[model samples]
Target chain A: MMTIERKPPLGKKVQLMATCLCDAFYDDAAVATVQVLEHLGLTVEFPQAQTCCGQPAFNAGDWAASRRVARHMVRTFKGELPVIVPSSSCAAMVFHGSLLAFEHEPDLPAVEQLARRTWELADFIVHGLGVTTWPGRFDAAIAFHRSCHTRGSNSAEAAATLMRSIPGVNLVEFGEAEQCCGFGGTFSVSFPHISEAMGRLKLQHLRAAQPQVLVGVDTSCLMHLSGLAEKEGQPVKHLHVVQVLRDALKNGGLL
Target chain B: MKFQPIDQFATTLAPEKRQSVYGGTKATHEKRTKLLAAQFAEPDHLRRLAGEIKQHAIENLDTLLPLAEERLKAGGAQVHWAVDAEAARRQVLAILQRRGATRLVKAKTMVSEEIELAPFLESHGIECLETDLGEFIIQIDHDHPSHIVRPIIHKNRREIAVSFEKNGLGAYNDEPEVITRRAREFMRKKYLAADVGMTGANFVVAESGRLVVVTNEGNSRFSLAATKCHIALVGIEKIVPRDRDLALFLNLLARSATAQQLTVYTEFIQGPKAAGQPDGPEEMHVIFVDNGRTEVLASECREILRCIRCGACMNVCPVYRQVSGHAYRSVYPGPVGAVLSPLLAGEHFLDKADLPKASSLCGACNEVCPVNIPISDLLLRLRDKGKREGAPSPGLPPMGPWALLASQPLVWKAALFCGRMLDHVPGALIPVPAFHAWTGCRTLPKWRGGEFRKWLRVRKK
Candidate 1:
């Protein structure tokens, strides 16, 4: 039988592990995440000791190497605080992927302990802090893209709830809302033609909605969609959900 | 830098035909979703039960196989065990030779495609005919099935009309009903003149010795009706312990496959013409083919054996929408194919190593599965297996460098400092093929490495 861990209650203090993609291409999303958390009255701690949760290597099937990096993550964020990650894909790698790599190891308990403390940014806001409504009014028409990693979790619902909570935010609907954006990390490079084709289809649906912006919880997906849009010369402003939420809160002076 | 087989096939396909290949599948996908939502208050409950029952049958194959064989034989049918594809071919050839069979009529079966039975029989100077409409088109054109259940999904109606015109099925007509009528008329003589008939069973009941076969076109039934001898090529994994388990599987199977409450024809064959029956075959033979299934069963991917050949995975797959079936270069394709085809290759896994790497691991296949197989998880396992076994891993960058860079903070920080240099370079001049693969059709965000950390530090101070 597999061992199951009980999750602790959400607390005031939380450590942040901004994903490698966020550090490289989406620092604005990370900054927005910290602001949103701080506005919710949570102490956002950034662990400089953390680099990555080893998702790229792990997804590529290098468990031996990924486990070493995953162990570093287990050792670096040594606290009872929840680890809030802006990307749902990165959060899944920590909670779900850590188990897939670290099997029968001595520090598996520590790995499991830290996994329970991980939360996606949108999920953390709606569920962790139980903040259902936001007193912000930055209005814009936007479409939300739910990344594939967030499929079996409540993170998509959480993100949608947070979106609906923003006053004057018109959440537009489009075709094939649940389809993947084809940015499977290395998959984009591995099969660029197919990736571009998939991205083109996604863009067609999002564009049909006539949204001013494309919002999503995962920066990797946003980057892929934004890049494809820019290259196609039909670029739409793509922002993380936290960025939109933070800007709204700042516009309303609720922070 | 190397061409992945799937991407190669997809990129070379005519751009105009892309929508045709995906249009029908997308419609079926939407139909299945709506039907399941309307039919069951909790459709997932049925899917879970079916998976559990299939898994139970797989676990008890040791005892169930013998029971099914004994009951089937006792009911006036012949049961043959084949340890591999070669053994299966030999047994089938022997049976055909003894029966003096010269012409064979076939229904749609992916297993025959797996064993390459049609080509092998034709090579031996026998006329083999496919009676199913989509399959008949594939056979006439000398092409392959693009989807498992919907065989000729890759070709549009215009392509079919052209193939029909070339093969003299009729004049040039691309009407959907006309194409189907032409096939039905063409198959009538083949069924009557053919001395041997072949099919693949969807489920074999151990308790009652009943073989269940379902089809929308009633071709499987027609293939058996006028033939003197009938042969059923069954995968050993296609077994259910009780006859009633068909209720659970049938409910999920039809809805997941084509969004029907039930297929037009569902046949249950206990044995040949029982005691002066008006119309049925005189002889019935069931060849239980074990080609690579036992090998797959012994490994970590045993849950794939629970597949019901619904073709739901292919419909929902993003990669499959672009590449279709032929890209897989195997009988199975799409998300399930990505996991199964490689492991099914066994010792020759290197030959098909690129299949597992073809997917984005989007987990859509698992959601649409009637049997609740975690295909994305299995794809990851196969990728791991492929890497460990030294398969030629293309389309994937070397993870070793990433491991070194991501495992340590000091090294990672230093790399980030250097990454800022990427901001000065244009997207096209990055020189990394992986990054260039991205920029070839998309723009990259300006590098903002360490900006988040520096800001966080200032806020803390």
Candidate 2:
């Protein structure tokens, strides 16, 4: 719940919490997150002691397990460096979810300490670093999957602003903008049909939007959306918001 | 799949039927959102105030409930207290029996459904007819109401026509107007012959002892008009502190439930014709049904009692949109059902234990909630409660192992090393049930675990 420093000169160092999803399936998003921070001249520190943010167990309603796993994150990322997470849900876990999961725990103060310094990648770019416009340019139309957790937070506006800052980037509009893509961690596996039904509906809107790529801050959502698309052999691709930014930076003659 | 978990029951419904549910809810959701935005500079302030009012009434229920009872009694209404569904149904049956009323017209009341009052009365040889159009369709067809506010939301006009035709209302006319007309004509006869009317109270004003009921179709007004005996079965939680609070709750209940600024009929009943009034029942009774509400109020998730039976949470919940109301398989359905159903189950809490896990916890329900019930957090707590209570849960792995692995850095790194092997192995070769469930509909990306850490370590070196 730390107010992200809107007025910049946020200390140049930050810890990259390359969440469980990034650690398992999408390291590139984590890597791009670091590159983006370095491009903004921050010393991106990888806390080697880091593991998962405990959102999976936390969200599953296992508060004890969630707190146990999340406690490790609190212990690992103890320094004052602002923790940057690639996924909005993961960032939310640190800042918001931790507070709830640890609401009554003796270690709540420790949890709050970590929560104070957490920021989603796009939110960090827009507010933490004060990076509104980008020198990078990639000319492509894309539909941004405004993941559900973005609601009630600055992440959605922050992500939209960062995406629009690229000169040639086009953010296509879609219906049901507030809808979730339904990749709710274990929800997809537990309720495959219901989760698929929502994913199908979301993809239908995205396809109707006719974008070249589907971009989102959380790989968890994109994974479900992209996987569903791939299951049906739909040609549209999905990428993390950081990956798209990475592409724009690469297209702008950066190695 | 007859009594399967929500997910399994949902898999049985055709995609189009589910789409119809989503269509109904999404239109409602968008309308309410736009209207709220247009009406208030801060709709949330109104929502917060409403929540606070309900919270105040409930927290002070010891005084409020007593005050409401005395007020209703002072207004010449006989008051009955029922501790459970059976007690409530028994009181209604006893009253009907004493009044020698066999034929009754009933408004759409979720409380009646909660008590299975119609079926129970029918078993006692008293014919209870549903007067509300949607409830009529549900009653004649022997179908359950999928959504509380919109009973037949899961029933299409085509199916309604079939049900109507089979029930001898008409000969297979699916036109919406025609269906309404036929239902109206049939209900007119039932109202004429009915000796008693049963209704649900939307709000019980403790200060005035007034029972408030609203209907879009004016059926409750009709139900009250034609009957000499009237009974109201209300939840203990429905009580509000004062009469003026209705101004806030009525607008919210109407707008949040159906996007109406106000329903067509907002009837304030002051008990049994009230000294030679032109209309209303001559004899009136009010039953305060606890039905596990006090326990809910005592629990950490007491905020759920603030629900005004507005289905906005259902309208905006993606899971509810796809699965529809019946998937939840409770008198209340969707996000509210997911929380309240299990709790309402009381000693049989495990019966509906799966309800809490039914949501994806996307928090859409919380966002659209009129009274600002923290539905998502309640769902989380219910899951925790279920776990603690030893309810039969979904066949997911124990969280302890996952938590332990994630907490230990070396174990997590080694697990990431093993995760790379998943990239090479065919998903089919994996023996995990959860994996099979995942790959059934979606493909997985190749594992690149620990690569970020490796790159970071090298860069530092």
Candidate 3:
């Protein structure tokens, strides 16, 4: 279990890509992401030009719609700055999807170059930038909700490693963390019963963990879980992992 | 009597509650899957074993087939090799003719459906009866199986009662136990009177040339035990190298199929009844049918052969829940069937190309697959193959404009602009059939009068 160390000389300029889910449901997560980046002495820039990485359309057999969205995103984010996304789903969409969509296209060489520069926030902080320090310390039990996009689709160990690094944060393990939260965008509404059923199952696991907060990178999953949690009146709160880190750094303890 | 296509019967029987029950049950299934996942934390090792065994079997199929035939023949069993479904039917009919099998009792077998055995036998004046309870209900109503495991999953109890009444079992109750008992009583006489018992083997151990059939109801045991002559119709792919392989398969088969630790009865038969046997079939025969399986094995689609017929993939599938299995119109349906049906049946049924597209590609099937087939990837490959080969495309509109627009950013932007401007277009100008299926379910989101890329460009400036 590797802990994220908060090293000195943390003041650095970084750009953040507010994932589509964060922008839509949990705008607080975006603010927290920026706050965390800045509190660590890093200047954060928000790229407003972003909309979506076009994953929903791509998964729904609408490859053309996905490509259109992918090209737009690639064109919008073309620069030398390291792009960080709060949500692993969107990050994966950018890192892996862009290359796939453009692999057979005539302009694939350029698209592949753009894809190489993208990163999920945890991966950026832990693997790329090598940041291991937080400004605050909180002594509360928390469980990391490994989103399916982050676990099966992306890499679970990477996110788990980043969380374990934060001090005083007791990360509890639950069953089937790699399974989908059933927030498959259109999948939720299309198959509402199955979607809700899957959501309830996830909620049950979260309750079983008895965590003070449920942390995940994807706000879509958080939103779905939050709705169910609110309905069930569960004590567990859903928050992005970055928010906890940001609170620890700024407040010097749990918020 | 031939088993009729159940799709029509189900549609008329319980059209109203069918969707809700299917949808509700799927939700329950997901919850069950979560619990099952917790109970079995490790990756299903049985799937890996089944995959390895199948791969070994396919590689040595040439040697194993003859070896199996020789062993069966030595044990007083006749072996018939059928090249295709037609030939398979002829061989079975010829055997029935030799034995004068007028009434036949059958255990659940997908191969029998593949060769359309019931109809062929019925047309030739032999009465075919389904012994499995689910198959019996479908048989009484002249319905094709809706799910491979549940058969009548689309039908509720009331609809089943009506079918039972229509078939002269009017005293039957709608409770599951009662209905099962009714089916058993009705089938009991047929099982005794039938001259030949027919079944499909789950796995044929090539080492001892033994056939294994697993079932919960014990109907299969009675079907084979009561009859004077027993005939087993098996696909060549069902052969495994050794006996111990059954332990690995038996572990996963029931659990994956119905979440049971083990099915109630697992019967292994090497040959017909030996001397002084209390009760068993007096004579035994095994028919090994290739029926395009060799072609499938030799082709790039060999992974499809790893299927154990557990039907877990179908139970959790979102697409199968919506359309049920009948829409695919094949003996097999859902993920495995989408790939295998086209290959086994030929390209003429390309109208079923929609079957492959029915999935959301959520990868649930792959997760629960006993053999770990990348069903979504295979389905995509089949779609691409269908398009390239100039299949009929099920009269669906061409995807040329969508494909072209997606490939080029400028063209897509223009299309988005036109779409946004004409957001209120009364669906008349949209001549594309591709959008029809989409719009039928939900309205396309309004484009907000400008493309995101164009907005980004202005903001950057």
lDDT values for all models: 0.87, 0.85, 0.70
DockQ-based ranking, best first?
1, 2, 3
lDDT, candidate 1, A115-221, per-residue tens: 88888888877777777787788689989998998988778889988888888899999999878998988888878899889998999999999998899999999
Query: What does the lDDT read for residue B356 in candidate 2?
Result: 90
Task: Give the true-structure RMSD of model 3.
Answer: 7.7
Better of 1 and 3 by lDDT: 1
| CAPRI grade, predicted model 1 | medium
- What is the DockQ score of candidate 1, to 2 decimals? 0.78
- Model 2 RMSD, rounded to 1 decimal: 2.3
lDDT per residue as tens, model 1, B221-246: 99999998999999999999999899
| Candidate 2 collision pairs | none
Predicted complexes: DockQ each: 0.78, 0.67, 0.10
- Residue-wise C-alpha lDDT for candidate 3, range A4-86, written one tens digit per residue: 22122223666677755554345567777766666556776665455667766554445556777777777777766666788
lDDT of 2 by residue, B249-322 (tens): 98888889999899999999988887758877899999999989999999989999998998899988898888
Q: Whose TM-score is higher: candidate 2's or candidate 3's?
A: 2
Q: Which stretches of candidate 1 lie over 4 Å from their true place?
A: A1-6, A104-106, B426-429
